[model samples]
Target: MTRTTPARPVSVEAVFPELAAHRSRTTRLHPRPGRPGMRDSHVGGPMLWPADEPWPVCQEPHRPETEGYAPDEIRSARAAGTWPASRSWPGGGTPGEGGPVPFMGLAQFFRRDIPGLPAGPDRADLLQLFRCPLTHGSYLERRYILRWRRAAETEDADDFLATPPQLPLLRWEDELPEPCVLHPEQVVTYPWAEDDTLPAALIARIDAWEDAQASRHGREAPSYQSDLSIPPGWRVGGFPSWASTGPLTVDCVSCATPLRLLLTAGSEEMDADSHSWVPLEDRDPSPHANPTRLRFGRDRDLHVFTCPADPGHPPRWLLA
Candidate 1:
């Protein structure tokens, strides 16, 4: 089904004309629970992986005693309405031991389906996302794996793995994402209210405007942050909301080039406070607000930023 965002109650540009300069477009990937295929743009679905190419895996060390289960097994357990106490741990060994731990297929996006989706190296048309079930590094971050492939090349491969080995031992059950189909919709968005790029005087004016609005309309009064600035959901290529942690400067470590937001996996399609962002078709109050059912750290949104100068550079992620 096609999802459409309702028109903004108030014209932000009309109220703050100078803020028009920061306006940009973002593609909302309205993910709904469904059966997604290998060739389709989807979340937690089969990917168009080359048959001969070896599947990617996580080599980082994980506690050998932790309970583990593969993605497919997890789905099966969910269907059966019973999560297993323990599952076969792949590449099992003692603590600090490392081996081939299969990575879960998180998401896949085709340039043809999503507008403003950043191009991969060599102008590739498909972007595949993967994540290790285990947390790694000092921050206990879930490692994200990216692959840029040509859809045409995988079409006539000698053979493909209809069912790839689900070997990764997921540490957290919440990390597993249920399969979801995408309904891509492009919409206008502006930077966060606390974005450092905006001039201080304009911010002061906006603060004054917000205060006056509160006085007039009380809690329901439209504010720049929640109602006008950013839409909350899984989206591609737009400004990131720093509501949780103020503004942050994200730059490429390989080079000094400023990075751009590539994708965001938010917990909610629209929160209670940001009802304006709810799609017209889904305006009716319902429990389907979180179809994907995936939650990030502390229920925060995961924002991935990529280097514009070189797509091959490692992308950075921020949980905010």
Candidate 2:
């Protein structure tokens, strides 16, 4: 519940109140390597599900029905806080080894912790996102969604048996996410892409402000718009630094309301030169690598966008 500090630290509405309407907010799930338990905001952390609830499965099909199985070597390695020495990957295989595989916990959010979340699936308190491990047709991975009551609501949360399915994995072989505590910092952000742009009048005003700052003295004055915080590493709110593709916009198909950035999935703990994103007080002195071996996609990022006006609206994912 700490106050959000922007990277460059500027107030958006303060300079131009007109631009307020176009302003958007995001929560960076700053994931890292740690031993986060079931009741924590973390990526790849332990799930707080009902012990008796049947684990999820993927019935989705794949290219060919070629099937073979690798034992629990990788799982054992992950449990031991390390990666397997070797893996048996599918050059081309069926949807699964045989039966349905369980989904792995990707992200968890507490309703009480985040203030702006719309009414979502798990009408209770906890929002858990599970990704099926099987690779479907043409690398299509299936996802299992669970919106459930908070772990605190259940008395036997710690005693529950959470199962992660054994399915085929590719690049994420070494990318086993460790449980890390979330240090939520709420920062203001602007749409960096033309598709997610402010109104023309607002853009003009921002241009004028940039011009004024340009005329101001000293090298510290903002020259480029990016001089501010396009934070690297794992963060919640703020503009995303696009790589493969630029900033994208996915409107709520049902309501047509512009979706907002809900998550930024990255492999590393910190991107180079994003020293500002690091919290003032952090456990690790060397912020370069996360002790957790999780990578979003090798070194790429996965951006998940959700509806701003309606939480019931389906979300969209963009790999940038």
Candidate 3:
């Protein structure tokens, strides 16, 4: 006699109890579009991760060894005719002695969140349930974060205007935020609400974009992964004058340690190139007199300076 196996349950409730729980949680919270969630702020602010939650398992970390080229080696090789001189470095430079070199790789490798997903499951779920304030679409979007120097605050300015007007704000779509091209080690998410004053319509759009990403993810088959690289035509910009004329100081975003500035564009090869961030030997308070000054505003932002103390190492994402 043959033995028979018991039949498994086929009901919707049986196959995915967790999905049901997710739905219930989202329904209970009923977050309005643009409202602050537990993981991220409705207004711009730092990202918060819950201590008790399990981190998502599907994240891909950045692999620098696999994707990056050594600056010194690349430069030497180029000088020897091994690599093309026109090749651009990510974050855009060779590491100098005094100042920290700007990171020159992909941005995705530095962040850990899933592209297009909120920082945590709670925010992701909340965003999924949110309806577009304007179109009522269920899609979500992603945005990018940009950094810039801060200017002094003024009493007359609005509370939101405390930072410099030229400071680059990190912005992204709620649906599919771009991954750091180099670091793939981390994912960039909404660190804060935009201006601490997001409109409901905008929030809805974010939610819709996120939903769209999820749908696309589900429908697509997994594909082979490749190393990230800078787009051919793109180049990193924005260096400060202090970087070229040394004794420069820069603080790390992660550790707050001070870095020293060393070397600006040195040598004839660096000087001849219009788009290179060559290291300098020392501060030249009179950098304005240098011919490179003409390149500023005309070709790119002034080169900023930094040092390589602990925690002051440039982020890898900036390289690409």
Which window of ten consecutive residues has the lowest lDDT sum in model 3?
A: 223-232
> How does candidate 2 score on lDDT?
0.58
- lDDT by residue (1-320, candidate 3, tens digit) is 11111121122223323223322100001011132222331212112222332222111121111123343444355346464233343453322222211211111100122222222111122111111111111332111122211121111233331121110111111111111111111111111112222355543554464456457775331111100100111111212122223323346665666532211121111222221112232123222123111122223222223324431244211111
- Scored by TM-score, the top model is 1
Which digits, one per residue and each the tens of the lDDT, describe model 1 over residues 12-98? 999999988989999999898899999899987888887788989888875454456565667788778688455655445323456
Model 2 off-target regions past 4 Å?
1-25, 63-83, 89-98, 115-119, 139-159, 168-171, 193-196, 200-230, 233-243, 282-292, 308-310
Best by lDDT: 1
Scored against the true structure, residue 220 in model 2 reaches a CA lDDT of 47
Alpha-carbon RMSD, candidate 3: 25.6
Q: Which residue runs does candidate 3 get wrong by more than 4 Å?
A: 1-14, 22-85, 88-93, 102-320
How many angstroms is residue 87 displaced in model 2 relative to the true structure, after the best TM-score fit? 3.2
Clashing pairs in 2: 26-237, 27-236, 28-235, 28-236, 28-237, 122-147, 267-295
| Ranked candidates, highest lDDT first | 1, 2, 3
Each model's TM-score? 0.90, 0.70, 0.16
